[model samples]
Target: MINDDAQTRPLFNKIALIGVGLIGGSFALSLKKARAVEHVVGLDRHSTSLKAALQLGIIDSFTDDMASAIADADLIVIATPVAQTTKILSSIYPYLQSNTIVTDVGSTKADVVLAARTSLQEKVSQFIPAHPIAGREKNGPEAAIDDLYVGKKVVITLLAENADQSIELVAQAWRLCGAIIHHLSPKEHDQVFASVSHLPHLLAYALVDDIAAKPHADRLFQYAASGFRDFTRIAGSSPEMWRDISLANRTAILEELDSYSAKLQQLRASLEASDSVALEAIYSRAQTARVNWITAIEAAESQNKDGGD
Candidate 1:
């Protein structure tokens, strides 16, 4: 029951956030701060996260029952892990209002879009698939912050023409959360994120596993430096969530993994041959690319802030 006068400001009457973890809690905080939602209700399988969200005042009310939580929600945000999207959708599909707009924060889009299309075709027009490219190694409601998505990228994948209204509402929601929204086809979204997001997670997991498999693993770990620590920080992310993402985007991930393997083999050959020229070239290219990417990201953030102002 948000103020009716706020209705013209992209604020919803009620927002039901399913799975109140980091993303869900962040959404709630942003909505409250922006006065975008009159009331926020939450649902989560974990009692600890639900309690933390409540303690943080991220939600007005919460429940374990999905239907009860989303009954009259004008906006429904599915913030569960990618694998849980279908299951959660099934549980709440029966309770969704006709005009209720649903969106997700899952990393991958194809699987989620297909799941919604198959299970809730009648309401699929109200469904908008989105992925907020903002997160930290830390998770749970306790780690949530109001500015988590500030100056970050949010991808919205719209497959059906009838989803225009839902897409606009989803974009407005992210805008209120201080995010820049980009529209991409589900296939394009999966392919792009497979390399940028999925592959990085895989690399982090593999790097940690490789280090741990060494004969003197403890000795190696003891000597790990800032670079090693920073690169592997995401390896600390929820294994259950990463496991789902890895499996869901298996095709694209495998392709990228193969490409990475080839590069690794090339570097190994160069090192074995004492090919200083090749090594220097590879290192120099990587350094330049990293610098350029950092510059571009900073510029984007600046532009986003300016636009908001």
Candidate 2:
């Protein structure tokens, strides 16, 4: 159980946010909003982002030195891209304190867990893997919001080496940020997100790329409407970040891509055969599923609001 005094006292004396971008910046802001952290130290290889984080008050201070940044930190959050997990964890290993709890906001978990196992080795118990199911299309510290995780879901994948006390502390920190926690094994998390989150981003990027590569790209873009804009909005996200994510979770993503390709082939066959019944059956089912999912989401949000009040 979390301490009842969580509401009145800070959960951590200091927090180290290794990457002060959207997710990390927002986490710091949310913790400050909840009065759950006394100090936040931001670390990033990009000095420009570090400057932005300091100016925006996303962190109490910014540092390039990993040792200084994580020194005495009660919690350390590795918020970099998934591909950087191994490097970041290895760098911190030398300085990581036994009492400090380490967590990450990576989208995929299997690879991260493997990286933790490889990098942290026997001390892997101090590391807890987490993914916050929330973000905006925008990036950087300027895009962060204090309420980004409010009413949002955060998935936690526990390591075999983890202690119950360490797990609870990490969970309590996120709870203070207003994130509802869910548990899953690393493989389950990667598989689920590959289908829902990763695949969608890949499809959006592919669609946009296909159109942009055509000779009439400018004309098509000039006439592009809300549907195109809405569908390809994710394509405007950081390509570098998405590239890392795609490769990191390629196994699950490839499986999902194959499944999506089969569905697309069925649509193509229906169109070629002029089978209106088949097409309508597919469209109707998709529409109904979308509507039902949205309805459930809205209901859940409303319930959360009422409960909070």
- The residue-level lDDT of candidate 1 at 93 comes to 79
- State residue 27's C-alpha deviation in candidate 2, in Å: 0.2
Model 1, global lDDT: 0.86
In angstroms, the error of model 2 at 33 is: 0.8
Q: List the residue pairs that clash in candidate 2.
A: none
lDDT of 2 at 32: 92
RMSD of each: 2.0, 1.5
Q: How well does each candidate superpose onto the true structure, as a TM-score?
A: 0.94, 0.97
TM-score of model 1 relative to the true fold? 0.94
**Cα RMSD for candidate 2?**
1.5
Candidate 1 on 1-309: residue-level lDDT in tens?
Answer: 223465575478788888888888998898788878778888888888878898998988888777777788888899988998888888877888887888899998899989998877688888888899989888899888998998888998886645566677788889889988998998899999889888998899998999899899999999999999999998999999999999998999899999999999999999999999999999999999999999998997788789888
What is the C-alpha local distance difference test score of each model?
0.86, 0.92
